[model samples]
Target chain A: MMKTVKIKKYSGELQDFDMNKLINSLRRSQADENLVQHVARNIVDQVEEGMTTKKIYQMAFNMLKSRSRISASKYNLKKSLMELGSTGFPFEKLVGKLMEFEGFNTQVGVIVQGDCVSHEIDVIAEKENNHYMIECKYHNSQGRFCNVKTPLYVQSRFVDVKQRWKSQVGHDTKLHRGGLYTNTRFTTDAIQYGTCVDLMLVSWDYPPQNSLKARIDKAGLYPLTALATLTKTEKRQLLDKGIVLCKEVYENPILLEQLGINESRQRKILDDSLKLCSAINTLI
Target chain B: MMKTVKIKKYSGELQDFDMNKLINSLRRSQADENLVQHVARNIVDQVEEGMTTKKIYQMAFNMLKSRSRISASKYNLKKSLMELGSTGFPFEKLVGKLMEFEGFNTQVGVIVQGDCVSHEIDVIAEKENNHYMIECKYHNSQGRFCNVKTPLYVQSRFVDVKQRWKSQVGHDTKLHRGGLYTNTRFTTDAIQYGTCVDLMLVSWDYPPQNSLKARIDKAGLYPLTALATLTKTEKRQLLDKGIVLCKEVYENPILLEQLGINESRQRKILDDSLKLCSAINTLI
Candidate 1:
């Protein structure tokens, strides 16, 4: 006998369940075809009439977690990045650290004098002979997407900064390289405009192999928000005290004291960080 | 000797001398012709190079404070009202109390259902055969004025509420009267539109006789911000605790203990409240 099914949305509104949404989310994690189908079917069969979307996510996440840790991390990546916005300063700092790991000397939250106006650059990175003026867009909500207007606005700002630097300090100062980085995905229009304007666009999944997710995974520079051992408040406290990278806690166990995590949880976090970092090292 | 003159603006920008501005401001306070001239001339003469507008105001205020207490209060009225915005809740409470003293049974911060939408009415009052909805516009800055757009927005909201009440409960519901009450002066356009629309406009000096200032003066219901005895934080604390009216504090001497004011200061505050209230009583 068929049963009537309803799922509670994030907004607490109950609606008819859609199987395709779960399937797409699972496929995005690069789960195996059979496992994805099996997980989706299992969730549908187990889901009650009034189960919340959060509980549904948990059921699927737990199933994915057992199969593949990396896939589970990728599935939970968006939420982890969203948690970084407890304070904007920490997110900028994390972005700077990520750029640093990519072999660029970076400065976070710097006020640079442009010819016409002063611009606050989120991240300024310098490689061998190139300079990048990065604008880091952070969103606290999962539903917020970086759209075309953002790139357009940032490109104009970048032009002003580039012109100012060229006029004031001579043409040798290369401030033309501009990038818009966001923890969320960019809209199709944003990608098109950014590519046309030669503005570097870095988001969660764009550029496939060199996207923000790939870079973080390759560098083993997971943000503190990625650690499931820490509570939301604990992660916020850690971020507040300027601890953004899980590697920081791994290198110096003393930082975990700030989180007030019990001895066992602290060990688990450190062990997880070390194992994750080593696993990335093996891939390289 | 001609002194190098400069006046620092509220935005902290220093500009060259302008004499007419000061003269016009003094005249608007309804000061006597000679007093206005004398005060303006004296301030300009005593003003040193690079002196702020605040210092100039203090010089004129000191002069007026000694000559006429009413004039001084009138001159300082805008600033006093601005302090009411330390928190919006207290200002709404104060407006409700003012309405209560005017023989209307008042409610503060009530959510009323409209036909198309729900509105959080700032002050709702009911009398013998009339019901009034008041929207309290509170501004924390001296330069901010209630403009035409405010009344236009409020008028639309009033229509929704009126329509909803009419449709739901017939014509005898008595939700016709709507008033826009603000602690600051209204723009000329706002006054014109509100007058044309028959929306009661109660501001600092509009309508001449029954203005907000006049009503507060007649009722002797000065807000806690009007008390010169309390510090900024102390006033905020009193406002937060729902002790909005000086009359409330005057009747309850125990409230002073929460402020941590010394015996002498507490006595002074109570005395000032009693004197101010009695002064209004004498006016009638």
Candidate 2:
């Protein structure tokens, strides 16, 4: 029988460490079973009571990084999303691209006229006469939840913009919806308010069946920041170039060539991105 | 004839220097005419193209400080408001006190139940069967305007809370109004939207005859941070103690005594506050 170890979560809550959950997460990275088992055994020996989950995650990530870069990258999805930048431009662009892949015609960072004023909607998506004015609330740090004030404000903005949209030509019968997307979690009041207001609330692991993370995994649209083969500087350069998804590198090998990387290194980078885009159960 | 020097504003707009405007501002500080003329002459001689209005104000303020501490404190009203702290707690307290002085029964930082959820209203005031829910938007930096989004969201929160208030006992016929007060300025669009929505808007200098600055002058409720005699640390200590107004210090000198300042320095501080409270046209 193994002793239970209580680990501290980011929200400062304590929970018993589940060895099976750790093993399942490592296995989802598509790492070799032997390597996953070895890492799990090492972590079990080193685990202590009251250790932060973030510290535990770092230990596993470093172990995986030393063995295989692609698996490590796949294991680092949440942190990768956070590194997209604090200004939220890259995150907005990523959200716009994700919506486009979901078969919606999307516009990123457009200024729309409202009933009383104009609003800079983060992403606007339209499909089958259904229009969504989405706002992306990105936080650089953890433990910061989108509070009820967020939905309260976003709902008002959507109402203002919808008022203008309904009065436009040939748009009277279309369904208009407001969406609030964030890389972080939302407070209980925020969720309740958003649900009550009919806001399409999406966070990192919310909504059970279809969250931001689930949507990304389902679409196989891993962000470029997740690639372990790319250095932080290189990832920033790619983001600056408006290339967000791993599929962008897998399809266009010319991007690596333009970055002046050696042929062998480019091949390794391309292989990792290709495997990442095709892998099932990429998110833990 | 003096050469026309272009002065840069905080908004990055360029305008010709008006020496008379500067002179009149100094005069409003209630400084001696000779001191005002001396500062104006020195500023004019040193004025050059593309110097910021901030720099000009700093020069005049330094000159006034060397002569009259009371006048210098009054001249520094805008900057003093900014020093009230970034969290906006002190600003809310000051607003509540100011409203109380205007014959309203005021509550600061209260949580009120809304129609959907609860809201943290900054200040709730009632006078003559009229109820008001006020939200204070405080910015620590210059040039940060309260945009249309601020009023848009404030209006929503007001509507939600107002709905709940209407159902309460004996409150059916009372006039409920929403107010947005800011320490800084507002964009034209913000003013337009707020007025259109019937939200009472007050910023530093908006609604010319009845702005925040105007109310502060009329009520003689200068913040303790406006005193030149106190150090920044001392002002912070007083704010943390919930003693926001200079009138509080003027009426009760023991607050300064408790800060462990000697009698001479306390006398100096009290004298300055008394003069500041009695001065007419303290703002320009």
Candidate 3:
């Protein structure tokens, strides 16, 4: 069936289902051409009026899962990121790691002196003549967009911190920028305010070219939680131990042994992580 | 037995027991002088190291509850204000009523045009030549202080709103200001930023001169949720109907009848409300 169907988004917004979007995501999972077509067709056939995008995603994920565990894990990246933590500290660490992978000296949580007061900045990244103070807004709950108030307060803090940074020696020539990164979406007003104030706004799908999802996919920085072989408990344990990247598991197979997994299971898990991260950039 | 005890506050901070503060609270409950002295003596005698201020308040409340429901209800004012709903609309309305009692023309939940965008102002009070844009931060959980981020964002919103307000005709000679009211305490940082930006901040125990608790008691504008006679459901029903003040019950006993409360009980409840609000200002 080639019929157009309305799909409800996490934000309760309704929009006509785009077949190309689903196909593109499935292809991004590294699924073969035949399997992608099969999954896309299955989703299109099962999709009905007022079905939530969540349900549609689940259907596609299940189809992909029955075929390839590696592809399924890749497809499950968003939900895996959501499992990071309620407080978003793990997510902050993930972001800091991403920046580190890109040759930036990054601090996950550091207390920075502002002009008026001190601020506990989530991530501070410094690279060649460029310094970024990033605030990571993580919501475990779906559809909780970072609103205008976030950027409003963040902008003020940025101004205060930037003022203090400017007063330091050797900072005069350095480019200091403020960034807001959230796992979920940013409201239009948040985007507007953040943009108006020249704050780098990055969310799941915002800013089109270099969104959080795009950056993660490009970097092959899938979180350890995204591994389908790992249980929730195992995922949480890995997260607790600061093993955020699937690439970390592949690099250190002994970490699985530390988790009390059998030698055979450790090999399987490590193999899966390696195959998933085979396309990862050579920086790490 | 009159030894000083290091009691823990709701914010997890340690503080020494002050008999005079407890005694003063009892006196404000409108309990007789003898009862206030007796309660103070009992609290002082029972005060133990590491006991929470919450526990101390509960002990005093139970002692007052047995002697006088009116006094207990009055003493329960802070907790009652907290029960004004989780979303805090009722608290906003109660604030609007308090402002109304003070003869200021007030609008709660007003949408005002800002310089760049629009803002949903919590409370806007105007009188004579003064206009105030107020934001109310209500927290159901105890010890959640309004942090510096509050004033930081509020100041930005206020600046945006004030700029738009100034553009209107006949506003040139009038004074525009910003106010922030919270049911909880404000962090020292919040107070500092607010003060620096000239934002009038009123919290439960802040300012010492004109705090939220003081204003509510002084105006005799106790929330209807403070009535010990009303059940949770009944209070919610009254709150839903926009009947926030205890004085509203005294002025109109029929509201109880609307809640399916019988005649005799309604009379008793009204009498209790009257006794609680008997010290109300003549202006109210």
Quick one: best DockQ, which candidate? 2
The runs of at least 3 residues in candidate 3 whose Cα sits more than 4 Å from the true structure, single-residue gaps closed, are A1-21, A42-59, A62-69, A100-103, A127-129, A170-175, A260-284, B1-21, B41-59, B62-70, B100-103, B170-175, B228-234, B250-284
Per-residue lDDT, model 2, residue B38, is 95
Clashing pairs in 3: none
Candidate 3 C-alpha lDDT tens digits along A1-284: 58887899978999999999999989878788999999998988889999999999999999998999888988888898889877788899889987887899999899988877788999999999999999999988787889999988887778778998999999989999999999999998888778877898999988798888778877777888888888899988888888888889899888888989988888778888887676465324
Error of 3 at A131 (Å): 3.3
**True-vs-predicted CA distance for residue A221, candidate 3, Å:** 2.1
Q: Write the per-residue lDDT of candidate 2 for residues B1-284, one digit (tens) a residue.
A: 67699999988999999999999888756688999999999999998999999999999999999999987887788899999987999899989988898899999999999988888999999999999999999999998999887998898899889899999998999999999999999899999888877999999998899988778877778898999889999999998888887888899899998999999999999998887776544444
Q: Taking the candidates in order, what DockQ does each have? A: 0.02, 0.57, 0.46
How much does candidate 3 score in TM-score?
0.84
TM-scores of the candidates, chain A only: 0.81, 0.91, 0.91
* DockQ of candidate 1 (2 decimals): 0.02
Candidate 3: what's its TM-score on chain B?
0.91
Ordered list by lDDT, greatest first: 2, 3, 1
Q: Can you tell me which runs of candidate 2 are displaced by over 4 Å?
A: A1-18, A27-38, A48-52, A65-70, A279-284, B1-17, B30-35, B45-55, B62-70, B231-233, B260-271, B278-284
> What's the TM-score of every candidate structure?
0.49, 0.88, 0.84
Model 2, chain B only, scores a TM-score of 0.93
Model 1 bad stretches (over 4 Å): A1-24, A27-38, A48-55, A62-72, A147-149, A167-175, A187-192, A207-210, A257-262, A278-284, B1-284
Error of 2 at A73 (Å): 3.1
